[model samples]
Target: MFSYSILLIAALCGAATSDPSTSTDLLWPLPNGNTVGSDMYSLDSKTFMFVPAGKGGSSDVLKEALERYMKLIFLPSPVPALASSITAPMDKLTVTVDSSDETLALNTDNSYMLDTSMSMLSAKTVYGALKGLETFSQLVSTNSMGQFQVPSFKANDVPSFLYRGFMIDTSRHFLEMKTIMDHLDAMAYSKFNVLHWHIVDDQSFPYTSIAFPAMSVKGAYDQNHIYSQDDIAQVIKYAKYRGIRVVVEFDTPGHTQSWGKGIPNLLTPCYANDKPTGTYGPINPTLDSTWTFLHTFFTEIARVFPDSYIHLGGDEVSFLCWESNPDIQKWMKMMNYTNYAQLEQYYETKLLELVKTIGKQYVVWQEIFDNKLEVLPDTVIHVWKGGDNWPKEVYNITKAGLKTLLSSCWYLNYISYGEDWPKYYQCDPLAFNGTAEQQALVVGGEACIWAEYVDSTNFLPRTWPRAGAIAERLWSKTDFSDLHSATTRLHNHRCRLIVRGIPAQPPSGPSFCPHEWEE
Candidate 1:
């Protein structure tokens, strides 16, 4: 963290800075492009038309997204009484994509080119087209005369990482469906491809399981707080339309108190003085019924969430609880297990196999790697806590030949008072000093919005702008290090979000939106 004086100086310097007037490109995730000049492509209600470039029928998703973008960018809020007088050359916005099939699959070819020379956007898939549309929308800004226009430029953009993601922990606080959808909308605008839904935890289990409905019925905050199967389907469908994949996380073993309440004897009972205490530990790893229950439960989750990956949280398992249980201790002794870490390894091994059996890959937290647990090559290790040695944890995990995603640098919930997003912006996923081969195993990172200090009212503001920093970091080039330039672009992006009905706070210090202030 930089000192207060340094931050103050940077803020003051940023405030006095002007937009890059000579450069027509104001993209958030800076694209790979060559700027032409200050020429502009102007549009009005009557002049703008979204057309397909080729033979196939138009995509409903693309059409709807373009319409939304048109209204949000062209139609100012509280509508100006003289708006009808605006005019421009009859301009056509053509979107060309190779495929329009919206299967909600993981798409890595999100490369798109916006040729202002021809007023056209082209991509290999609808997913890329959606990303291109977002960039195109951001390019639309006000001219000196207050008329909306997109600067003329040709941009070829692609993400720096394949799995650009944002994780929302709904277990600590049950975020309403609308809140989730709103976050999804923001993620789409930022070009995030994955939504890591931490749906269940120790506090509550909001996912209503059809195989075991009692999980949510007994564990959710209340009857109305649970997300029915339909709600999950709706959220997934909504994300699909925006080109985002929803990955459900059913945190296990450690964060299973909610599950224990839903099902009796599922958790290991703790013991004191050789007698059963009135407390319980995590799910009983030694019990055959535990495996049965998990198989049935995750089988249902696999059926519901179409994504090929499921997060089985295997972090923070307290060995004290396992040691307190006589049955677990006895089983450990019989199995020749010397420590509780070994028992955790056994549990994780079984759970990983269970997830694979259900035809899905598994993601676990950094603790799995910290404990030296042997994980399969396919198991993705999510590094959240780095202790004092931040890079070492990721280095160890990646060097061991396991894929990793770094989240230690982007915990959005751990907020300070002011100008804190730059830290998130600067923390690169590949910043860890590692060899090229080791760094290649690092896929991407997620800005985690842990729900402990967040809810519907604060979650949107708390996540946006800050999460946007992480979005740009993960998508743009690793060497793109110009904090002054980023501050200006992010400030504009925050206001842009607000205009679209997303209450995103300014990235840093005091700021004002031209449209909002004028209106």
Candidate 2:
């Protein structure tokens, strides 16, 4: 745990010159606001009322979120009577939306207006109201006199893109449900609406399937690491309340080593010197049993994850094992497939069809594009591994009229030394030179935290403040391009998250939150 003593020391050192008037400039995501005056509205910490009006479909969720933020931003009881006596009258923080409909649909108009003069939030939908609440919470800061207050301003805000997301790969290492929820909370705070959960990979299959219990029993890291169906429901419900869509990823074909352990002969048996090499290839794409298992497996997945889109990981298909398999080679000769890429195309085509049958659209890694596989127009292309040619690949994919999400520039797992977040901040999903239509094909992007090098303890700090950069880039105006300005706001945002109990590391240098120290 981080010590509040350091915060106290830092606060005391800066107290002599600290100015509360600057709070107006501290809002993250930089809302389009016109400052009405150089005035602030002080909150009577002990008596402020959080009223939810309009009975929006997400009224209950909004109410809970408001309560949590209120408690987090305000000082607890037991303050000196003298301080209480001098505080302003309690102000009503009213959150009003046109409707309470909580349907987690894409492009649901998360645009909101916050009127500081009226202390009210208005939005077309509950999702927008939730985003406005986050901005409102960020606007609150403590005065030198130690009273919490919000700067008086009127602002309108909306996400620049529809799909600001973060992907956490859990298969490499099982993360606790608590840890997952903690990340979701942080995502909500940052205005990230999508959680692309890479639930299964080569190392382990943590999602237990009732239809195929052996999948987890034999493939998981251990018995205790599996996520029961009930656990899945709990996570989905939790994310839903925070206005986040949880898109589950069950990586297939290539990263299915764990699956073979649970269901035998599902993998191609690689051979050496005409003898079984005791190693397996990608899922036996040539087998009828493989299709049957995949159909059943994906049917369960579709039921588990409610999001309209599923990530079908079709990346890094190493064909060495397949080449080593005599059966696969014979099949290739028989099928007249000129190359291994064609075989992968065959598998992906089948999988995509199966997913469509399950009534869910699919997102695949850039390998699908590389393989030149013909896919439905609605399929989302996740651009992750294009190396030095990444920009070209993204441009080409969009030019070809395919909707794409760029993750190549935001791979958070590639850790480096010092202030690396600016790179992520500068990565614009629409940065490429292209026609307006091509650019529009760029739906959004995600900060992928591949868990090969992360777990619960380090994942939070490593993910945050940095991922927050991408969140801002994806949400704020495309013209908002001042790195220096963004850095100052990001610094403040980091402290705000810390004060709210998220272990968000300082993006660049030393930082302190007075409220945390005071608490």
Query: What does the lDDT read for residue 91 in candidate 1?
Result: 80
Clashes of 2: 4
Clash totals for all models, in order?
0, 4
Task: Give the distance in Å from residue 224's predicted Cα in candidate 1 to where it truly belongs.
Answer: 1.9
Q: Cα miss at 29, model 1 (Å)?
A: 2.1
Q: Residue 257 lDDT in model 2?
A: 91
The candidate maximizing lDDT is 2
State every prediction's TM-score relative to the real structure.
0.91, 0.91
What value does the lDDT take at residue 124 in candidate 1? 78
Q: In candidate 1, what are the lDDT values of residues 51-94, reduced to their tens digit?
A: 76642227777777777777765744211111122223438778
- lDDT score of model 2? 0.79
How high is the lDDT of residue 82 in model 1? 13
Off by over 4 Å in 1: 1-25, 34-36, 54-57, 77-90, 105-107, 144-146, 515-519
Residue 121 lDDT in candidate 1: 88
Worst 10 residues of 1 by lDDT: 1-10
